[model samples]
Target: MRLTRRRLCSSAIALYCLFSLYAAYHVFFGRRRQAPATVVRGLRKGAAAARDRHGQAEQPPLEMEEWNPWEGDEKNEQQQRIKNRLQILNKSTKGKTHISVQIWSKAAIGLYLWEHIFEGLLDPTDVTAQWREGKSVVGRTHYSFITGPAVLPGYFTVDVNNVVLVLNGREKAKIFYATQWLLYVQNLVQIKKLEHLAVVLLGNEYCNNEWINPYLKRNGGFVELLFLVYDSPWVNDVDVFQWPLGVATYRNFPVVEVSWSLLHDERPYLCNFLGTVYENSSRQALMDILKQDGHDKLCWVSAREQWQPQETNESLRSYQEALLRSDLTLCPAGMNTECYRIYEACSSGSVPVVEDVMTTGSCGNTSVPRPTPLRLLKAMGAPFIFIQNWEELPAVLEKEKTLILQEKIERRKILLQWYQHFKSELKMKFTNIIESSFLTTNKP
Candidate 1:
């Protein structure tokens, strides 16, 4: 009986010790296993919260072993390097300025004039030498040319102080896309990324204000200046400047070769008109009047039904020769009283007989205090025959036939001098304005 009790006591003690060991194992080893699981769960919850705050979908958290604490630090260092480079570039450009010219390559006149103006303003010596040598002068300025939409985004990287956009408002179909691009560019201006914006607008024949006003108004404060072909009385904005003539003749024809002797020489034609003749236009009216008076025999007139955007090399040469040989060029009003013929005639010392009557269009504001036709040309002191009616042509023709060669030579000299002076004054004013308003070192 004693042996049985001792064995039973030993078995009970052994079972009690095993139970204590099992409890100890659970308290130590089991906690270590659960701790990693708990940590993983907490990390996932934090990642989920971060995603929610950012309005993004929750993504699986990277394993703890894969996490790199220095990743964000490396990204911050890269950004700092970029900022430093930009600051260095800005400092280097002090006392010097850069300008970006955004224009359509097809607007040949605008392209030519802007290039010429910049060349004269920045490097006149080179331009004069090239001209004297009978060589074409490619202008060198701190200016970059951007022609198409594809190049626009690349322009953002150009370190420029000012931007000049040349717009042809006559192209009705392209205005919508142009407006959108302008608006996008305006946003950059709003953020103070771009400094100044300017526009050289080629006014439509109809002088439709609708095509441009929306863009002007949408970014009113952003635009620094505007150069418009037609100056309406209603545009009292201080930023607007009048552009008197298109640069076509100076670009395509050799106006520099014209001399007093050439202009004074006797010619067969009394007047010339070389352009498309629109139905019901003043051109058609002028043609009819010339035909009735039998003046076609004395005038060089070539009329066509459709307007050609581009002139062939032969046609261009013929046009230039006609201007050189003629005493007067007929510039009848089409959509507007102003035409390229008037400017071309001036280049060749051929007097322009402009039809002064305003055509039917949505141009010039009559309500303005000083509403006048061809306000820009009048402002520039252009000497041209301005007649209200085509019926008065016979009287002018008679007067021209009566004038002596000396009188015609004097007139040609006066016209040539005036044209040269006009271009010089324009270059000076444009350079001064740019220096004062855009190229100044002062910044707010």
Candidate 2:
């Protein structure tokens, strides 16, 4: 019995030693491998739970919050850089005189004056004048544009060292308000407080001199420069700015860089007239003459009883193409003898056949120059056919039919070259005049 009991005790002690060794290995090496597997399993389970709740696997959240701890500092540094750049530009142009442009935004002419006319003349730093009531200063020049009459009164107290007043002469409201504004500016001029004042007066009434002439005659000396749309001998102090080409109509259209090769293609029509037809108007007379002579078959004539304010994209394109393809563009006088069509046709290398009769309007001094219609075109050396009556259309067509392709091409080149030179010369004169009169002057 003693021997059997001792054998059993030895066997139990060996089993206990084996179990301790296995536990020691598992606590150290085994657990290290199992820990990674356990973590992976947990991640899978979490992702599955997320999918069940959201119907999609969720991405692990990013540490963006940790990365952007210095956000405010970064923004401040960027703003400081912009301020420093503007300050440097301002410092460089410190001695340059500033100009303030006060204009109504709705006026299409105002856009032309600011964008096309003044773009090359003034830098952003050159327009540092401020208005009490205006939208944020435009560009780097800090030009305060007070748009409407409601805020115009606020400009009464504002400084007008060098100012441009843009007025649409056609609108009744603009005329009324402009009269009031001019009266105020006239008072300042009387005291010699306002030295450099320029006016860009647009939309002159066809024959009526009463609206513009009286104001201009009274305030002529007060105004240093006058940019008039339709020049009149009655208003001899005015400087003529020709009716700009389809810029106001199709604002984005490139009227300057027309494809000469495309324009040189064989044209199907001798002339084109795309405009409104009014009763007793010269356009009606032109239609009558065209119909009688069967010239409608030889020309591209599209006329409507009423005038349209805007054209569709397709119609605008068609009109431009017509101008490009036609040999001549008929420009019958509307409210004035000089219309935008004359300039637009010139851009397309289409000779303008203008009706040179002075429409029943008070444009020029009747006594001195006999108010020759289209005097502006004649003065500009425009290569156009001027006719006193629509009866002369058949004779003009006869002459056109005799011209050969090479002759037509030569004419187109000459017209295109002249048009370009005209614009360049005008720009040079405009810049020189402004600099000499307003910017370079030492007057306070």
Which residue runs does candidate 1 get wrong by more than 4 Å?
1-106, 115-157, 190-192, 217-221, 249-256, 368-370, 439-442
lDDT value, residue 251 of candidate 1: 34
The lowest-lDDT stretch of 10 consecutive residues in candidate 1 is: 131-140
Off by over 4 Å in 2: 1-106, 113-160, 177-195, 207-222, 237-254, 439-441
lDDT of 1 at 25: 88
Q: Which lDDT value does model 1 have at 3?
A: 100
The clash count of every prediction, one per candidate, is: 0, 4
- Residue-wise lDDT of candidate 1 within 252-286, one digit each (tens)? 54434566466668766899999899998777888
- Tens digit of lDDT per residue, candidate 2, span 188-232? 767876666667676564634356554553455465666666645
Q: Each candidate's lDDT (Cα)?
A: 0.66, 0.66
TM-score of each: 0.66, 0.62
